[model samples]
Target: MTDDARARGLTRMQEVYGWKPPEIDGAFFATTVDHLFAEIWSRPGLSDRDRRLLLLGALTAQGRMETAEIQIHGALHNKEMSEEQLREIALFLCHYVGWPNGTRLDTAISTVTARVRDGGEPRMRRLK
Candidate 1:
């Protein structure tokens, strides 16, 4: 990948996720920065918030609240969404994705929001 793509990806990563990723070596990481963040996320049509909502839905549908929590944390940290709004999304999604997944999302919203409010580091960083 071009240095420009990597640079832009890191910048867009901070803008979208509210943190910088540590340097890592892997084809997955390369594609993530070079393509996902640099190209898809930085694309013009959808705002970051819009993309975040879509990601949340997909993650929830896939029973991936652990991953969803990162998005939730970023949304709360960056002021892209309010706790109430996220709660409402959980309720709305329940009918579509199933109650279990919705509940999982609600739990993640609570956990991530509390951490964000309490000035805790994002769980993703802690995991690393």
Candidate 2:
């Protein structure tokens, strides 16, 4: 198990969608980055699939589709999740969170899936 999968304070915060700070300070950036991917993510309590779902829910609840797609792709890549699951999550979010939020999530998911189907990088995806 790597530290990226752990749940120290900052790590857990980054696991959440839209937690990025306006400016990057070396210590704060590394600390939060590690905390999200390592400490909290390191816990075995949640499966990768479930983690994706949780992030979907969080993004929807927060109405932040911009950051949500990263987790969406991460979910798809990590757990081999299908678009249907992402769609379902968007739908579920509509009920608990709000219709407007769901719409945004749906749009983001749809756009990502469209690009993927076209064999292009999803818009939210960063090129390496």
Q: Count the backbone clashes (under 3 Å) in each candidate.
A: 0, 13
| TM-score of every prediction relative to native | 0.94, 0.69
lDDT of each: 0.89, 0.65
Lowest lDDT 10-residue stretch of candidate 2? 14-23
Candidate 2 lDDT, 19-124, residue by residue in tens: 4323344654565456655566667787766777777788789988877877765555444578887888788888999999998998888876776668664343
Q: Tell me each candidate's RMSD, in Å, in order.
A: 1.8, 6.4
lDDT of 1 by residue, 24-123 (tens): 8778888888899999998899888899999999999999988899899889878889999999999999999999999999999999888887889677
- How high is the lDDT of residue 62 in model 2? 92
User: For candidate 1, what is the TM-score?
Assistant: 0.94
